[model samples]
Target: MTHEDVWRAIERFATEHGMSCSGLAKCSGLDPTTFNKSKRWSKEGQPRWPSTNSISKILSSTGASIQDFTKFIEPHGTERQ
Candidate 1:
């Protein structure tokens, strides 16, 4: 999946779990701004990647298995291009 697709999935997952970006970050033991959309953009206007540890904590906090998150990483109906 593309970076854009991954980001979209993350947003959707957070919504489905009834979480704001800051809420999710807090649940993951990260800084409140860690998952904020504003922080997604870097100084050069490029998207930054979420850290693996943060992702892991988020999944655990939401009671979602790693497999579920992985599926989001490569959702169906989205071409692999």
Candidate 2:
């Protein structure tokens, strides 16, 4: 998936769970800013993808499968870098 697609998936996953990105991160035991919009990009304009550890934590904490998260990548146009 494209960088934007991946971010969008995370955003959708959060919304599906009735949480904001920051709230999801917090619930997953990560720093609240871990999924903030500002953290999705670097100062040089490159995309900053989410970490696998964070994804695993979120899935584990929320009882969502990888397939469930990947479904959100399907051209929904949510978040972006």
Candidate 3:
């Protein structure tokens, strides 16, 4: 999937798990702004993706598997896992 797709999944995962962007970052031991909207885009307007290490940390914090997160990347109205 595209970087934006992955980021959107991350956002959905956090919300589904009852955490705000900052809350997820804190729980994942990252800077509170790590997942903030401001970080989703670069100064050049290019998409900014989460690092694998950050993804792992967030997965651990939420107890969600990669498969579970991937479910969020399915079509906008599709069923969720």
Highest lDDT scorer = 2
By lDDT rank, best first, the candidates go: 2, 3, 1
| Per-model TM values vs. the true structure | 0.77, 0.89, 0.83
lDDT of 3: 0.84
lDDT of 1 by residue, 1-81 (tens): 666666766776787688887887787788988877777779998878887888888898899987777666665476344
Candidate 2's error at 65, in angstroms? 0.9
CA RMSD of each candidate after superposition: 3.6, 3.5, 2.5
Clashing pairs in 2: none
TM-score-best of 2 and 3: 2
Supply candidate 1's per-residue lDDT for 28.
73
TM-score winner between candidates 1 and 3? 3
When 2 and 3 are scored with lDDT, the better candidate is 2
Question: How does candidate 1 fare on TM-score?
Answer: 0.77
TM-score of candidate 3 to 2 decimals: 0.83
Q: Once model 1 is optimally superposed onto the true structure by TM-score, how far is the C-alpha of residue 63 displaced, in angstroms?
A: 1.7
The collision pairs in model 3 are: none
